[model samples]
Target: MPRVTFIEPNGTEHPVEIANGYSVMEGALNNSIRGIDGDCGGNCACGTCHVYVAAEWRERTGRQSEMEHDMLEFAEGVREDSRLCCQIEMSDTLDGLVVHIADSQH
Candidate 1:
């Protein structure tokens, strides 16, 4: 299993232990984590699952899809670290990834 930690804007830490192969959004949803609305249910058609990857983990997470990059352009708080949780697939490489949910989604 992998773990996805959401560092809320208010500085709260919400850690969710996720099973292999599930997206970070699935992890958040299953754990009842707040701040990740996942409005489009991981379809990559919505920006509601937008989050900022921790600077240290960005490289390991790899590149974002064109769709994600384009959708992020419309996100309220897009940043260099912005990523759609639905597009972030879980794997051993992302076992301990930490993502910060933008304040706008809170």
Candidate 2:
């Protein structure tokens, strides 16, 4: 398992241990972390799981796919670091991954 830290807009942090092969969105939802509304159930079709990957962990998270990029275009507060949590799969290499919940999903 890898630990992921999800920071809320209000500066609250919810860190949880996520199993390998699970998406970050699933980790948040399982832990009851707020602000990540994965409406499409971890499908890249929805951008509701939007988050900002911490700069230090961005490289490990890797770049989004073409479909993911297109979906993110509809997300609020799009940024260089913006990514749909559903697209980020957990792995041992990303043990200390940190992501900030966006202010809005739509």
Q: Say which candidate scores most in TM-score.
A: 2
Q: Rate the local accuracy (lDDT) of all candidates.
A: 0.87, 0.91
lDDT, candidate 2, 23-64, per-residue tens:
999999999888888999987998989999978888889999
Model 2 segments more than 4 A misplaced? none
Full-model lDDT, candidate 2 = 0.91
**Model 1 per-residue lDDT tens digits across residues 3-106:** 77888899899877888789899898888878888989999988998899878888788789898898888899888889999988889888778898898888
lDDT score for candidate 1 against the true structure: 0.87
What value does the lDDT take at residue 48 in candidate 2?
87
Clashing pairs in model 2? none
RMSD of each: 1.0, 1.3
Where model 1 places Cα greater than 4 Å from the true spot, the runs are none
Best by lDDT: 2
Model 1: colliding residue pairs: none
